[model samples]
Target: MFELKSVSKTFQLPNKDSLQVLQNLSLTVNKGEIFGLIGLSGAGKSTALRTFNLLEKPDSGHVYFQNKEIHGGQIDQLRLVRQKIGMIFQHFNLISNKTVEENVALPLKIAGWKPALIQARVLECLKLVHLENKNHSYPNQLSGGQKQRVAIARAIANHPDLLLADEPTSALDPITKIEILDCLTEINKKFGLTIIIATHEMNIVRRLCDRVAILDQGQIQEILPVARGEIHPQTKLGKMLLEIT
Candidate 1:
């Protein structure tokens, strides 16, 4: 569904020194599968995930969605392509003032869907996340778990081909985290949505992903399949991630 080839990114520090975040990173994500990008903080997991939709433009690399490469010149094309990709964040980026229904309807409205269709689609998305009852409620009124579910509903409301989740469960309690994971699993199965989750937690990867990529210091340490049977991680970082989970 997506590919990043020799992608590299750097940030200039206040003192004028350069810090490289991703160095020649390359990876591919298959359709209809839950793929994970796992690493510690500052491992560039979020940056890598953002590159899929051009949210983080690489300094020197190619990002391909489906089969087409995204370039800076294709502004109009990029906007259209973004519609096929949905993203949710760790903090559950929601509008404080908007009701759940309106939040879910925002993308459809932007895409110029009629009011009736937006209303219907909003309801459908809310139902998918089991939040139909809270459509009229504001984000502040809901729990953390409910807020994340609403984010999920809003993200998938546009029927995006790919879903990018960045540190989705980091702010939740263990039970809430499990609930969110289960919700994600259900969404994946029901819609065949391709999901790419960036997280530091290996447990999330083990429970949800079909394959996992371990990233360290701006590069991919290794990629491994996650299964119930015993498996070995070849790299030091990969083994640590496996053992910690």
Candidate 2:
């Protein structure tokens, strides 16, 4: 569903030193698959993920979604492409002032959807995340888990074919993490959405992803399949990460 080809990215520090976040990084996410990008802090996993949404443009490579190159396009064209790809963040990224229904409906509204359709879709999305009852509530009124659920609902409200989640469970408790994962897994099965999760938590990958890629220093060290039976990690970092997971 998506591919990052020979991508490299760099950032300039305040002191004028250059930091290369990604160097010739390449990976693919298949249709209807839950793929994981696993890496520790500053390993460039998030930067790599951002390329999928064009939030971070590569210095020297191309990003392809469903075989279409995402490197250059008109603003309206790019906006349409982005509408087909949903993204959720670690911080939940919900509007503090908007009610749950309003938050979920904002994207559709921006797309010029009719009022009745937006309301219907918002309710459906809220129900998918099991938060329909909180439609009137604001972000401040909800618990952390509920807030993340709201974010998830808003992301999927447009019925996107692909979902990009950046450390969705990083800020939640272990038990709440399970709740969110269960919701994600259910959505993947119910909608057959191609899901890409960038996270440091191996357990999160093990629990939700069908295949996992271990990233280190801006490159994919290994990609491993997961199953119930015992399996070994091919790369050194993969093996080490497996041991800790």
Candidate 3:
């Protein structure tokens, strides 16, 4: 449902130098699939994710969502298209002032839903993430896992077709990470949400994704299916991640 065609992005440095962050990075994510984008830092994994929603515009390529090219200056079209796409950050971007329910309900509010409908959707989303009891709590009162769950709830509040998760498990402990991954897996299966996650954690990919892409220096090096026995100690990215974990 998402496609990036011949996408390239570059930035001009202060020293009159040019840095290419993404180079002809073409990728297609199918519906109801959890696709993993894996790479070390500075490999353009985050950049590629940003391009999906036009957070970062490609210099010379096209980004298509459900066959419609997304370009800047189309505010109404962007908003309509973006409602189908949701993004979660490494840091839980919950509003410090808003309660969990309110935070989750924010999108529905923006979408102009009535109060009763918003309340119902927020409750369902919180329950889906196993955070039903914490709806009245604030972000500061919750654990890291709870906070991330809140973020996930908010992201899916609109029933988005695609979810872009950037390093969703990077800030959590092992057990919490597992819980969060389980929540994502459940969401994918239950809602058939197309998910594209950018992460350095092979375990996350192994546990959740159906297909994986290895990126380096702004280019995709390899894209493979998630195999049981093939995720061995010899794979470079897998090995590094295992060592770190």
Candidate 4:
């Protein structure tokens, strides 16, 4: 579904220093599969995820979506590409003033959907996230898990083909994290949505990912299959993650 070839990104520090977040990172995400990008805090997992939709333009290399290069394109074309890609973050990026339904409808409205269709789709997405009853609730009124569910609902409201989750469950408690993962799993099965989750949590990877790429210091250390029940990680960081859970 997506591919990154020799992608690299660097940030200019305040004191004239340069921090390379991604160094020649390359990977491919297959359609209908849940892929995991696993690493430590400064491993560039989030930066790499942002490159999927050009949220963080890479300093070098290429990003491809459905076999077409997506970098340096027309603004309209990039906007259209973004519509097909949904993203969720650790902090639920909801408009506190808007109700759950409105928050979910925001993207559809921006995409210029008709009122009737937006209403129907919003309800459908909320129901999928088990938040149908919480439509009238505000973000401040909901718990962390519920808020994340609302974010999920909003993300899928546009019927995106790929979902990018960056530390999605990091802020939640253990039980709530499981709930969110389960919700994502259900979405993947029901819609065959391709998911790329950037997280440091091994439990999340073990429970949800089909394959995982272990990254360290802005580089991809290894990519391993996770669906077969046993994962033999070779890198030091990967081994540590396996031992964590």
Which candidate achieves the best lDDT against the true structure? 4
- Better model by lDDT, 1 or 4? 4
- lDDT string for model 4 (1-245, tens) is 69999999999999999999999989999999999999999999999999999999999999998888996557888898898899999998899999999999999998889998988899999999998999999999999999999999999889898899999999999999999999999999999999999999888898999999999989999999996556889888899999986
Model 2 TM-score, 2 decimals? 0.97
User: Compared with the true structure, what per-residue lDDT tens digits does model 3 show for residues 1-245?
Assistant: 79999999998999999999999999999999999898889899999998999988889999999878988679998888887788899998889999999999998988778987899899999999988999899999999999999999999999898999999999999999999999999999999999999999777888998988888899987788887524544467646764674
TM per candidate comes to 0.97, 0.97, 0.93, 0.98
Superposition TM-score, candidate 3 onto the true structure: 0.93
Query: Per-residue lDDT of 135-243 in model 1, one digit per residue for the tens?
Result: 9999999999999999999999999999999999999999999999999999999989999999998889888999988899899999888786334679988888778
Q: What lDDT would each prediction earn against the true structure?
A: 0.92, 0.89, 0.89, 0.93
Q: Please identify model 4 stretches exceeding 4 Å from their true place.
A: none
On a 0 to 100 scale, what is the lDDT of residue 211 in model 3?
A: 86
Residue 191, candidate 1: Cα error in Å is: 1.1
* Candidate 2 residue pairs in clash (backbone atoms < 3 Å): none
Task: Report the CA-based lDDT of candidate 4 relative to the real structure.
Answer: 0.93
lDDT of prediction 1: 0.92
Worst 10 residues of 1 by lDDT: 224-233
Total backbone collisions, model 4: 0
Q: Which is the winner by lDDT between candidate 3 and candidate 4?
A: 4
